[model samples]
Target: MTREKSQSIASQKLQQKVKGPVAQELKEMVPNRKSHQREPRSKDAASNSPVQASVQSIITQIQNGKPNVSGSKETPEDLSFVMSSIFPKETGSVDTSNLKMKPLDYERPDVPRLSFGLERVLFNPGVYHLRDPRSRVYNFDPYLGAIMPVSEFDFDALKAYITSSKDETLAGIARAEKKKYIGSSSSMTSVLSHFHYLLSNWRGVDTRMMSQNFPDHMRSFTRLLRSPAAMFLRYQNGSYAIDADKEFDSANILMNLGKSMEKLLTLPKEDFERYRRTHENKISAEEEQAIPEAYHYSTMGDFLMRSQLDAYDPRLPGTGMFDLKTRAVVSIRMDARNFEHGLGYEIRHVQGGYESYEREYYDMIRAAFLKYSLQVRIGRMDGIFVAFHNIERIFGFQYVSLPEMDQALHGQTDTSLGDAEFRLSIGLWNKILDKVTAKFPKRSIRLHFETRDAQTPFMYIFAEPVTNDEIEYIQTKNQAEIDAYQRRILNLEPKDGNDDLDETPASPEKPAANSQPTAEQNAQPDAQAAYDSSAPPDESFLAELEAEEADLFKGKEIMAMTLVVKNLVNGSPVDRPMVFRADDKWTVEYELSELQGKQVSRLYNACQTRREKALSGRGEDEADAASNVYIRRLRDLAMKGRAYRAKQDDFDSKHGTVVLDEDV
Candidate 1:
């Protein structure tokens, strides 16, 4: 058997021994039972079973009185009972002697301090002006309605109502107020009434909970029914009264609406942009603008209103303004084909094709970071670009790390960021503070970038130092191997059919016969000649020459075989080739005579064996260690070449095939 085959068998056996029993056990425990069957137990019953005697002994001890002890010690049973029954109650009582009650003052405090920055501007402008005296102008409503009665609008009561209201609604109102003043209408009144009703009847008929209990289709139908009611409340201006019981029953509808709105708000800006861009191509500009504006006002009005109330001073340096998004990271990804095209493969006028593409990506990121820093006071920043080839794999990245604006100017790669090129670019900004704390003695600023997919070319920037020793080590090893392989490839000499076969001097008669053939003799090809006159007799010639050529020249065929080795970690391929030369003995007398007379068959067999060993993963050096013994055997056999048998049985039983002899 070949060494490779033998090794494979051994490996299989070892793996089977290690994993066979465990696999079998798993299969048995989690057998392919019907879905109705109970789930399998995680532990074995026998292993988990407690000793009956030990349990009885413990029980008996617990039941019996303990030996006398000085200090009090609670028994396990007594402690269990005490813990089970320890419910405490509040008496709602106070000590009259310590409590002092003072007359209430209806007047407001002499000096009012503004806890929130925007309160002065919002209140001073009289933005709360209302048409109805009953409709008070509150900065934000704790309840859905602005018409809470004075009796139910105390500080604690207001807080409880607000706390109980949907968080999304409160947030939406806050956002809306921030953008524009919120006004009351009939729709708002209905919404307030419905919200209060729902809160009152919260115990029963919750449509949201009911939907969760029902199938998907049913839930969807319920949602459709509830959507109009929600929209009416958000947009309609009609007075509508909701029964308290009915409100409680349908509380789930409001909750679901809030959830849906939250989800809509959470969508990424890029996704929104993509949707808007795609739709813009299909619809007229006027229609597109109208739809978004109407949709925003109808659905997001509350949020916009809140935003107006909580506005911050945009003129102040470092103040984050809503419209200013300069410091935010932007990511770019390119497929392999697009990447190549951008590099100037299609437009050959550009010199550094791939490199130019990489540089462009870097420049874009740098420009974005710089712009963001200037506008938004970005302390550190990153930009990322990802390039993809085939979607499945074959992707790489180019990364540029700029630790800070200063570092970027100096053109130095940061060492504190991660070694991953994609991460260093995009996520660097997000991790700047973390990296700074870990690396610098004093606090410092940083930025980072990261790419999501591995199957694309990517570029990113980072502003932190990160050690990359592991990456350098891998690169060094690969380079070393590649260099060595190149040297070996270059050193291989081209072989000729008539090269000196041995260093030993030929005898006088042999030397005389070895002289160049006469013109007439050469013109009349000798069938017994070892070298083919028509062939160039070099490696290049041999490469072009097929098995048929060997048969035509040597009156026998040559065999070739290939074996592939792969690196287990990275899945890189390694190729190994084996060649054997053979010919029929009768047609070529000199070749057969030389082989039989010098026992060449044995040497050929030994070489084949060594080739197999090397192909089986044994290093070339290991195979070479046995070369001397094989060569000596071959030398002895080559001397008796003519006496060799013609039958396949003799060749097969002695040596498998011709093998190349290698130096130790």
Candidate 2:
């Protein structure tokens, strides 16, 4: 949902319902921790102080949770500590026969409960069925090609869905491309990556820097920890988020089958036959709109979840919210170049038929089902509706209900084990929230998790203060603010009797008094094919990125384009039009601030998109050449802002949000 729409919701009751600490602003919920300061102390005093002692005690408790193996014990999550359990096996799959669990004993609890107590479901989570990728970029507004209308899903709604067929019939229907979405939701990876720890690691193992059970879990961690600048980049400048291009990710044909099958099953056989004939007759190049994505945001005890649903059918068994899964028959080949990230794959669109992948189905199940089943039970979906297909064509489909997954994962299909896991998961989240908040309060932090074989898993976390580079940038911003304040105070001062009125006429380049720049200052040069007329960005957009009330973007999604404008080419010749010329690089990188970074990137990409079309020599494509002229006009404006920055006569600082590190 777009921030404009969220701010547009006129219903006071709906607004009030979602207002509170439990469903608080995303940033406030898991806050940033500032670096610490300490007074000098004797060795004994330092070791024995309450603050030091408690910190150590807390770490120990988080690493080694409550006892669970004796005659009587509790298997509670690390209270107050958020942990990502690492499975020591390849593929994160484990025999469910090893799980050992018990009902939690809160009477002897050692951690904090939620501030408002606990509940299974949260307030209205505005669910929008995502019909297209463009919708994600723009608002779920009606003017665009939005499939689902944006609105709050009342308590009665928010179930789930999936579609599976029993045969190869979907193959000849003509294939279409599925866009990048598997890693689209970072929240999904954050919330669901710890299943191996919950379901199979009966004994919490220290898993830091060890072999991981699933590739994506480790990959997410690596990307998040790449650099200090990257840690908060999503919040600071995320208009576009680039996802890992993975194998088995963009199976367009399979995605089509999953989206279409459930609804097709509703049609009569005669209608189906006619529809099939039309579908198979000839495939069009245009892609079908993505089905509406149903979001069910609910709270389970300490857990706050937003289940993204594919479809919902009450007629189907169990909650009827079947998770949609598209299983490709091809084997994965890991890209090991970036070793810090355990395993990732190159982006390749596979083209193959039934015989090519049939023999690989059993192995695919072994590699994927554990992760799949864990998602099913955790989200509490009815089950998973998996559509089987090779990249080229559909093979068959199957619906594995929760009971079936339970039976496969555990020895029984009864809800007993699934119930235990669910309660346990929520309890873990509750404990994590309490402990982490207590330890860091409102601070930015980095967490490192490790689970030793048969040993307790530990999370090592630390706070992040503003970086020196960021500090330097802000200081420059600060100086500009000071200059602006001085100018305002001077202008407001009682002027000498005959001072300003008789002064020489102001130059066209400098406005009279404290006033807006004249048309001459606004009309910048460098009116090449890649620049725009508008110059510097307003300072307010990049300063103090926080708001009193929170929504999805947390009040700072002013930029939505993630592409850097320097990577649009295909092979070696690929480098030709994709990148800016060498001289244009330095001005963009060192001269402009992050806000201008967004503007120039947008300006340059627009120029290239036009250039690429024109270069193709298509007759109608010359329109791109005209648009390039205006785009360059904007680019030049951004560059001029850097030169004029010393005017130092604009903007308020909003009391700069940066916290000074004690060590610095």
Whose lDDT is greatest here? 2
TM-score of 2: 0.31
lDDT of 1 by residue, 539-634 (tens): 443333333232222421111111011111112111110111111010100000011211122122222222222222211111232244533333
For all predicted structures, in order, the TM-scores are 0.13, 0.31
List per-candidate RMSD values in Å: 40.5, 29.0
How many clashes show up per model? 79, 41
- How does residue 581 of candidate 2 score in lDDT? 29
Cα deviation of 168 in candidate 1 (Å)?
27
Off by over 4 Å in 2: 1-195, 202-292, 332-365, 443-450, 455-664
